[model samples]
Target: MIDRVWTTNEKFKKRSEQNIVARSSLPWNHSCGSKSFAATMSTKAEIPHFVDFFKESHWSKKKDDWLDHKCMEKHVELENLRTMCSQPDAIPMSQEEMSISVLGKKSGYLRGYGVGRKPSNTNTTSRENDGEMIILREELSSLKELNETQQNQLVRQQQQLEAQNEQIAIQQRTLEKFQAALLRCRLLSSDQCGDDSLEGC
Candidate 1:
């Protein structure tokens, strides 16, 4: 929700600069300043972790941008964590708690930037990437379940068509039998009468 574009030269320049103004237009059932935010989340929640991450100084975008691309990506990841923590959806640890969490987790990246270093691999640094992958896999599994249900419905429809065709065949056979019986009755009456004309019999 915060829209302020951060800069490298002044990380945490002031409390105001560090603050990312949330999207203001959205109606807040829960205000950020209310005491109710504290009551909703667990003490061990990631809100604190997120707050800490931002406090560690944002990555500079210019002269000191020598950190690894993965680390930069990590920075973005940390920011996303912040958004998840302090945004309207992220309740309880609105300010301090959310900021601390992000800063704490990415402290290593900030240090590496100071010494002109980058993360060797961004994908495996923490369990965060793994967690995201797991979520995606779960979504795919749900989609697979939906597809299987559709296939079963299609099979049931085909079976119903087969059953209907069988019923039609039986009806045709019954009609033929009735017609044959009627023809035999007419022949017997005519033969028994021994009339010159079949119409008189």
Candidate 2:
């Protein structure tokens, strides 16, 4: 937006240097009287359309921004200039002087875009987009590594649980074997005691 407005203003200034209004007759330069009358026109007569010619020729796409603060501010400046030019004691100002007085502002314009500041042209916007893409790719790579680490941790935990289960199974089998041997020992002791009682009888 800013770039467009700046380009337009620059074009207008070049046009002014190469004979103003781009041509003798423009959409905004229609005189109230004939060409002969324009030759002898007074400052009062020209004041009404003082800023219209340049504005109409160079405004950006957003024409409705004519009511914006910056536009209004410049309009006021131009209006004051026109009024001053109509005064009896007013001195004639050069083109450069007129621009400095009315359009010398650091930034802002009729189309609500920056006028004299650094322009956000195509190259600048492209560079910004490239930077954003690089950052996004870095973030995505970081996330992928984190997911792989979590998966590895889960696999290690599962292996540990399986090993613990095998150990418990071995312990249960050993306990069952010891219980069988103890039962056999008790049977043998009972048999021995019966035989001794018979012998005594």
Tell me the whole-model lDDT of each prediction, alpha carbons only. 0.47, 0.53
List, residue by residue over 1-201, the lDDT tens digit for candidate 1: 133433433454454444435324322212223322333223323333332332233334454652345445545755676565455422223232232454343442332122222222332243346666567657766776887899999999999999999999999999999999999999998787776566665
Alpha-carbon shift of residue 54 in model 2 (angstroms): 49
Residue 142, model 2: lDDT of 76
**TM-score per candidate:** 0.32, 0.34
The candidate that achieves the highest lDDT relative to the unseen native structure: 2
For candidate 2, the TM-score is: 0.34
Candidate 2, after superposition: displacement of residue 40 in Å? 60
Q: For candidate 2, write residues 1-201 as lDDT tens digits.
A: 756765778876576556644445332222223332223233333322335543433345454444235555666677678777566444444332345577663333322112332222543454457766567657766776877898899999999999999999999998988898888889999999999999999
Q: Which ranges in model 1 have alpha carbons more than 4 Å from their true place?
A: 1-132, 193-201
Give model 2 RMSD, 1 decimal: 22.9
